[model samples]
Target: MDNTFARCEDLVFSYDDESRDVLCDVSLSFKRGEFTAVLGHNGCGKSTFAKHLNAILLPCGGSVYVDGIDTKDEERLYDIRQRVGMVFQNPDNQIVATIVEEDVAFALENLGVPPEEIRERVDEALKSVGMYKYRMHSPHQLSGGQKQRVAIAGIIAMRPECIVLDEPTAMLDPIGRREVLKTVKRLNREYGITIILITHYMEEAAMCGRVIVMDKGKVLLDDVPKEVFSKVELLKSVGLDVPQVTELVYELNKYGLGLDQHIITEEECTEALIKLLS
Candidate 1:
């Protein structure tokens, strides 16, 4: 059975005709329930490409298909967006309502969903993101991570099959970053929601099942995190970094320590080091 959820076919996009193409000949498919990470330096078109997934930005010369519906189809725009939700870098910008639960129900209310259903969905979404206790509180009272979770809850209330998050943790502190990442992982792992996370954090990318490295509006690499990060030189050439454990392993291998270059996690690196010592 074909499990493809969304796909971009020969996608070409640009801000304007005068500007260079931000996404050039980009073609990829996101399978159902897959957790994928997109990595790139600044202005590499990762965000531009993400916008196409939900019809926020139409392709200049090609097509973006969400569940077989063309994003260019004006009539199905709402359908496309409902299937694929987007979360951006700053949580403050995504939050609209002052109250947490109210914000989650905002979209549903606008869609004219039934009041009873909206209430049920809002509660479920808040609980899913572990922010149920803060539902009655004002969004401003919550921390950065909490705000982001509220943002995510708003999306979840819509029951999206896929989520495209563009650098969702960029403004968060180390602790906040961990909190958001944990919530994202649980969403993908437990709910079976397909995740497309755009981030510059190599460690966060390493946590994903798949990693796609983009440069100059093209995909430089796409594979499992271990295989993709193993090419440290190629990734570095594109101004991208590998996970810290992978970087350590790469340096050790260069010094003839013969460490495994594919070790992306600290636990894997520790095991390899212990074996080397033994």
Candidate 2:
């Protein structure tokens, strides 16, 4: 199996001819079945970059390829979209049908999938997100988390090779956020879907296999969570916050406390502090 799933080469994007580049000479690759989190402040071009993956936005210069299909080619547009699915932040905006199962079936219906296959796909998608039992329920009656899971199920029913979520948890409460994140992680782990999560939440980013920190439309850091979060000052310089536990250890180290350099999680911080005392 090939490791590379998505590739961007010298990708430059701008909204209009008069506007400056939103993404400048950005080149990166995402591996298959890897969960990657993209972190950046608003207007820093993370979402713009994501839009290129599905050809919602094409590069003003350079190129983007999803599963090796060039996005600039009109002939491959449908195939490119089928290979990558996108889920946005708002559940209300995403939900199209009244019933959960119907909403999941919407995309399949558009694709002209046979009714029998649509039923099988919808049921499998709903079950994958733990929302199978709620298939008959009205989408409006569901909680934010449940609605978002239904939204995800809609994408899953398409059976895309990759799923790109642009702040899918932004509008949800803590519980809703957890539910969506868990469902996404499960999709990557159990179903082997490549996940590209664009989020402002540091905690959410921590759960990814790789973290890419963008600033002023360019990648400033790309590394594993520990390495990326370790540079407390660098993250702050880019108008981003470290995870609470990481910040705590960083402040403690500033006061001459000895904690391991790689602490990113609360569990790791607690264990390190306990060992230090012992």
Model 1 segments more than 4 A misplaced:
none
Task: For residues 85-167, write the lDDT of model 2, one tens digit per residue.
Answer: 99999999999999889999998999899999999999999999999999999999999999999999998999988999999
Q: Which sections of candidate 2 miss by over 4 Å?
A: none
Q: Which residue pairs collide in model 2, if any?
A: none
lDDT of each: 0.92, 0.93
TM-score of each: 0.98, 0.97
- Model 1 lDDT tens row, 1-278: 77999988899988865588888999999999999999999999999999999999999988888999999999998899899999999999999997899999999999999999999999999999999999999999999999999999999999999999999999999988998899999999899999999999999999898999889899988999989999999999988888888888898888898777889898998999899889
RMSD of 2: 1.1
Task: Give candidate 1's whole-model lDDT.
Answer: 0.92
